[model samples]
Target chain A: MRLLSQARVAGSVLLLLLFSAFTLPLRASASGQVTPQTVAETTQCGHVSLQAMIDEAEAGDTLVVPAGTWQAPIRIDKPLTLEGQAWPVIRGDGSGNVVAITAPNVTLRGFVVAGSGKSLDREDSGIRVSAPNAVIENNRIEDALFGIYLERAADSVVRGNTILGMALPISRRGDGLKIFYSPNTLVEGNVMRDTRDAILWYSPYSVVRHNDFADGRYGLHLMQSDHHLIEENVFRNNSVGVYVMYGTSFELRRNLIAANRGPSGYGVGLKEASDVLMEGNRIVGNRAGVYSDSSPLRPNTTVTYRNNLFAYNEIGLEMLPNTQNNRFQENILLDNGEQVNVYGGGDLTRNEWAFDGRGNYWSDYAGFDANGDAIGDLPYISKSLFDSLIGVQPELRLFQLSPASDALDLAAKAFPLFAPQPRMSDPAPLTQPPALPPTPGLESPPTATNIVVAVAMVGVALTILAAGLRRSKRQRRAISAQPA
Target chain B: MNGKIIWTLAQKELRDALHNRWFLLYTIAFIGLSLALSYMSLAGAGIAGFAGFGRTAASLINLVLLIIPLMALTVGAQSLAHEQEQGTLAYLLAQPVTRVEVFIGKYLGLALSLLASLGLGFGIAGVVLALANGAGSPMAYISLVGQTFLLSLTMLSVGFLVSALTKRAGVAIGIGLFLWLTFVFLGDLGLMGTAITMRLPVEQLLWLSLLNPLQVFKMAAILDINATLDLLGPAGIYAMQEYGAQLRGVFLMLTALWILAPALAAYMRFRLRGDF
Candidate 1:
């Protein structure tokens, strides 16, 4: 009996230590909401009002909301945890913010927040968090003017949420997730579609990773933000994939920016930015893969593009005439309409096309590697006469693939007198393309139907040819046998 | 025009074309070269699998642009000029058939032969591509075939105009080749040079480009394959923006106008001329 009592006391002490380990962070962040409350108070409001539960609860109290459509324009003033048993709906009255969190350490998850006001001036949103350390995760925000607005919410986490903006005209629609003055915010694994822009304004040290932004005005528009890391995100079919204006020390890695084809269809546009590093990106099928306009504005700052694949774009790299201090190295510029075009009538000689004796692989580079060192013996020069003319007069690009343009270039090469000056030259261009990470989601292999169609077409063509020949031969034999 | 006389004349022309050694050789060469071109395009991409129909068709665009018009012009030019040179056209003209009937009949026969050659070549190439790689969407390939057919018709109409004006087969063929060269190179180069020198407005440039039947076919083919005129650059984008949903239809109409204008001119010249 004495030994059994001692063992029970030891187990109780261990349980207490484990419980405190879990609760201590919450107790410290919640600002002295230390009373441990058992039994998460089920909301008495049911479908009527979740705000009543928030009003009745103390700081750090966890409220369990049942699955029902609740009227929003709700506010959480104290630090609280609102957990939905199922995905509950919070429908706004189309006036102001739908679900507002004004208290620090508030956690909102497992809810479908919808129908905010259409007022861009008021900055209406489905979930507006003004307090720091807010966790807004796994909730689906739909048909809201602004999906999620994080205003001054430092160290906030916005994860795994699906934000679909209102179907207004692109200019009229608000941002999907507008992070204003929110420092060190982690926006990861979220999807934003059909929004005007996903704006990161003055949000320094933010990490936006693994998100998908598509069919918007600007996929990720960063303005005056510093030291942001955007990695492994997909920005597709937007007007501009990622436009960085006046940002410093931005790193974009392994992101796929594709098919942005709007008016200013840039996969990644940099305007007066400095110290930007874009590495390992697959920028494909865009109007211009990377557009630089007066980038690296400050002296001694540099913008570097390394190991990116710029494929099938109209212009792989388009820059302003005076844009300088940009370095492009170890990149594969494959089959763009024009590899690099300096917008207006100037050359890209100011920017460095090679660094450390390594240059990019130009698909149109005609030089061969004689010594098998994988470097071209002749320098890769961009001096096509037609390309230069098209740069001056873009409408002449209509004849880009015409025989006339080919003949013009051929004549220029033969005559050498008519050839324009080199726009830019890489001293050591790679004869072979550099290795690139395999693109995700390649097309499936040919199906049986594809084979059948191909065989049938070939058969038909050969049969026609055979029939024609046989008919002609018979006609000749008949005429010859008739005794002329 | 009497349908019976036209049919009889067309049958004669068709039989002659099929019997011609040069025509046979040209058809074989076209088919062989097209297939080889498709193969090279696929292999050149360094891809292990077959490229999609869009890519294969794109690679064939330059070859088609170079060859189809030349073949059509040569065949059409030889049709009337060779017969006239041998005095057989005069013998045929003395028959009950009218000049209009003979003209329409010859055009119809050559059109059928050209269609057969193009169909055989592209169909075989497309089938091989489908079997080898995969046909992502056959619409672009089908569109390319249709555009080439229209281009052949347009060039053949222009060839008939040349033959109507010329007497000797050598002279007609030479003129046809010259016109082919002009259509292939001069128009685009002249316009590009002019645009560069004078800085022509995009609208005017588009209009000038549309005047060239070859450019019309190229733009239409590219637009159909890419589903956007962006590849054509600013003039193409201007066309897209200006024409909106009517861009493809406009190109088709332009190609038709090209065919009708030349065919009409040839008919008028053949009717009014007293050379026979």
Candidate 2:
């Protein structure tokens, strides 16, 4: 009886904690009354352009438009909240915008906006926002040039919008949230497909979270943007999934990027991007996986990856030579043919065995961890072994995994799973897995993993530079003699 | 074979391209169209009621990829085949140059022409796009140049190879088209089939793909870009993605072979083996 009473008391305390956690976010939101009368008092419901519906409104106003097909090219410019009643269809008159807004602290919810004409110039918007603080939620936009555009808007939120179209097969078209020079925007819980790029941002500090993006050139795209978070999104069969563009710093965490290969395409393309954090995402069955290609003029872009689960992708995580200063840590990779090869000729720090000298968990890792934590404490280093042999020997990746794979794992420690030495990871000895079983079968027999692939190209700038140095030539010649 | 010879040949090709304003116009059109598309593509995102729907369809990745193969074929068709069609190769070869030198020189010239086309055409297009898009990927812009270079070299080499092997202009064009289609379209399909039948992981199949230079070049370019590293499914792709240059050594070797073997074969046939 006493134990039961104690248990009830503990349960009550836990329930109290749960209740606070749930209510805290709601409490944080600005307190407002949501009565229809209060909303009517705040807004001016008139038969005007879509912009008027937004401008003539104040905060906490829900503009209930009568059931009528409106015109296209409308603008919203205000800090007001508007909600359409029933299926309030805003139709473009084949010329003007359906809804154009330039307002801060605005929300446009539950509307069907469609039927805009296409033009070579004058990009039409189904629901365009010029305000920084805006939210276009729970809206269905279809059959317009651009479904919804957020231009030069910052710190906006676009949630629960379904956008669909086929404007031009070759040309990029209709967007759910086309954010140009917009920053700190959140596009969450939307379904976007059959367009050019699903959720694209030129501005930084954005989040495309919990969205379903399918059948676009790029599912979620960020170009020349930075500081974005892409989480829990489903990208299906897009040309490429979640393309993080150049000069962008972002985190693609806990998302499904899959099946993004159809009718001439790649899965994900990252060009000239830097300072990336990809964590706990599931990249599966795509044409390729996370490709980063930069130029010679472009400085090296840095990326940090951790705990990502990748499977059935082509060229998983490709980094070029111009792209320097990138790191991968503690990822769960499985069923891949070959893992972790580099191109573009740059420095490679294969510190798989750094943290407690353990490497990432690869299903193809022939090595074993005698201990259980599923981490091979020994460094799993296959430093360009296949590349070195591929010249004279054609069938290199034919037989087993890297024979010269000097893969090893350190003994299980309290927190060292690849205790990175600044090169591979930024902060040494970061967080540890909540709990990991010590892997018993780790550490493949040591072979020559560091077989430097000395490609003596006739025209490559690096090769010419190497030839310019005489003493280095002698060293290279000497090394070439029993190197293989 | 030397830099000076290649440079001179490249200079000549640039001169030829300039003289042929029609050819120059072709590139200019592509550049203008692509740039214009960049602006028009964004319009969908602003269609008022349908802005949300419009943004979802813009896949610049696929659009760029679609442009490449066509670019390769269109540019490659004009290589030696055009000169032969104009009956100018015989005159050039008759002048004080060895067949080997002429072959190397013409290939170099073609490469330079391709570079010019890229720098002026695609590069300008990319810049225009960057300006218009207000936030475009610089990496993709640069990648377009790289892909153009590698693809042009491959196509140029193939053109040279076919031109050297055949006396007929029609044959050269036919062969060039065949090569382009096989590489750009069927190469991946073939490898995919092989992987499925061989029951090997895609990474393990890369060694076999080395035999096919087109697949190798595609893979190499992909690796060079480093953006699609994660998209590569096999363990090999992972290795390439992580240690792209180190692992791409194989593809580089293959690309070198892809460029060199055809050029070398063409040269060998032109220099040593008498035709007629």
Candidate 3:
């Protein structure tokens, strides 16, 4: 009897040791003191219970949220890594921010943060981060007033996220990404569409690269923000592609700005901006490619545009009367309606059109190149009577492309008395257009409707031609048969 | 007023047009030029990929603007003046036909000839372009064709006015050419010069520009290419803002008025002075 009782106590002790081994980590995780190994063992949160898991998680603990719709207005006050396995949705109950990160070093990834409040005054957002060193990436955020609001969050990295704004009108919609007072933020590889703007105000030293912003008001709107490096980004179908106001020292390189037609309709607009270097950008199909109002505002500052291609825009470059210190060189201005327009009527003699014996290739330049050199012998002058008249009176542009305008130009050429003063002169205009990056081709294969339209047009033309000919032949026969 | 009499007279006029060497030459030249323009526009296709239908149609605008007006005016000017010069109108009027019937029938015949020429020329070119490059925005191209037809009718009406006013065919053709030159060149240049000198208000400038049918056609064509009419600059934006939803309808109504006013004037002049 004594031996059997001792064996039963030993079995009970072994079972108790195994139970404590498993329950110790659970208790540690519950107490918010989880080590890395303990977190790994107890990381999986119950489906649809994300806030509870986040509440119990310690600082620096990593939580793997399961795939389900999790209720939101989730607050992470401690530094933690919350990763979703299969894009678990954190849906707000139609009120405040879906996910708010109030602590430093928080990483939120692979989650769909959606359904924020629609109050613009409240600035409701899908993910609102207030602390620094937050990395929010690989998330799809949609139906939110603001996609991501990084307020005073320095050194934050927002990468590979797709942000779609609400279906509100452009004026009512909030910004896709708002970075206010956040310096040294890196926004890369993100796709933003149908938002007001990806605005950065007082946010200096920000690097925005490789992002696609479309169907918005302003692609990247910078106000009083300086020292931004914007590269390899696409801004298309916006009211204005990149508008930098009250800023200085911006470098925009290799960006594509296209089809931005709105009230202002500028691909790149600068007001009171100085020391801007715009290089190798393809600005195409906008109403005005680059519009400057008092740009290079400070004296002794130069705004340089080099090796950029301005093609198919209504006005390649438009500047106010006082815009000066702008140096344009080695760029290609091709097929724009007006290559360079001086808004409100003035000459661009204050700005430099050629530098270092090289100048932009104007599609309307009629000068000839001699001695096998690419540069033209005679200086290229942009002086049109009609363009000047339209400058003074913009309503006269209604007669554009009329024969009278061409005649007026011809008369000015024949009789220099009627010729207006040259708006600009390029002493070393290029004979050949500079090589540009190939435009990304749009896929528009011919559909069945196209084929049907083509065939029908041809059939109609031939039928008309044959009927006219047959009727004419019958009339000729009847007239000949009658007495002559 | 008699349909059978008008149809008979129209058939006779059409037979005369078919036998005329200049008409045939004009049709052939139009087709050749359209084809060449289309081919030249697509020359950059090797670099820019397949040039879409919109770009090609935009390029064709200049050709249509220059050629169509000249063709329509010359044909319309000769339609009545040539018959009156050859004393065939006296013979026709003596044969139980109203003067209205002769005027309406002759105009209809010349209109058909112009339509046939334009349709054949643009159709063949359009087919070639669609076959070569994928047709991007066929509606834009079709709209361009429709605008060109309206322009032709407007110019033809003006030519009929010149024909009714003149007694000699050569004189009528001369006056038509002069009017064409004036409309194409002097009118726009004068308006531009005046606008610069006077700084006319936007509304006044728009009204003055719309007075010229050629300007209307150019604006309509540009609007078709760019739906927002951004290329027309500030004036275009102002027009869009002012007309808003009815901009297209406004253009059409203005064109119709252009056709009707000159045509009614020509009919009145012919009816009053029906003596051969």
Q: Show where candidate 2 strays beyond 4 Å.
A: A1-61, A77-80, A172-174, A199-202, A262-268, A294-302, A322-324, A344-347, A350-356, A370-484, B1-276
Q: How do the residues A39-87 of candidate 2 rate in per-residue lDDT, one tens digit apiece?
A: 2221123334445444444544445553445554566554655656555
Candidate order by DockQ, decreasing, is 3, 1, 2
**Candidate 3: segments with Cα more than 4 A from true spot:** A1-49, A66-68, A85-87, A297-301, A350-352, A438-462, A471-484, B1-15, B18-59, B92-105, B120-136, B264-273
Q: Which ten residues in a row have the lowest lDDT in candidate 3 chain B?
A: B43-52
| Residue A231 error, candidate 2, Å | 1.7
Candidates' C-alpha lDDT: 0.81, 0.55, 0.81
Cα lDDT tens digits for candidate 2, B1-276: 456554555556656655655456656665566556545543421211111111111222333333444454444455566676687876876776656566666666556655655555454434433333322234434554565467567656766777767766677667766776665545544554455466655445766655655545445544444344433333444455556556656666767777787777766766754432
| Candidate 1 CAPRI category | acceptable
lDDT (Cα, tens digit) per residue for candidate 1, span A1-484: 6555545643453355355433121111122232323323333244236786678677765555556677888999998877664677889989899999999999998899998999989999999999999999899999899999999999999999999989888989999999999999999999999998999999999999999999999999999999999998989889899999997899999888887875578999999899999998888778889999989988999999898888767788888877888898989887677888888878878888899989989877889898989888888999888888778777788886678888988999999999898888888898877876654323544446655555555565455445434434556788789976
- Show pairs that collide, candidate 3: A404-B184, A404-B185
Candidate 3, which CAPRI tier? acceptable
- Tens-place lDDT per residue, model 3, A1-484, is 7556545654454354345434222222312233322334332343325676678677766665545677888999999877775677889988889999999999999999999999999999999999999999999999998999999999999999999999998989999999998999999989999999999999899999999999999999999999999998989999999999998999999888888987689999999999999998888778899999998987899899998888767788988888888999989886677888899899888888899999988877888887858999989888888788778777777776666666678889999988799988899999876766543323445655555666676677666555555655566789789997
Name the lDDT value of residue A95 in candidate 2.
Answer: 66
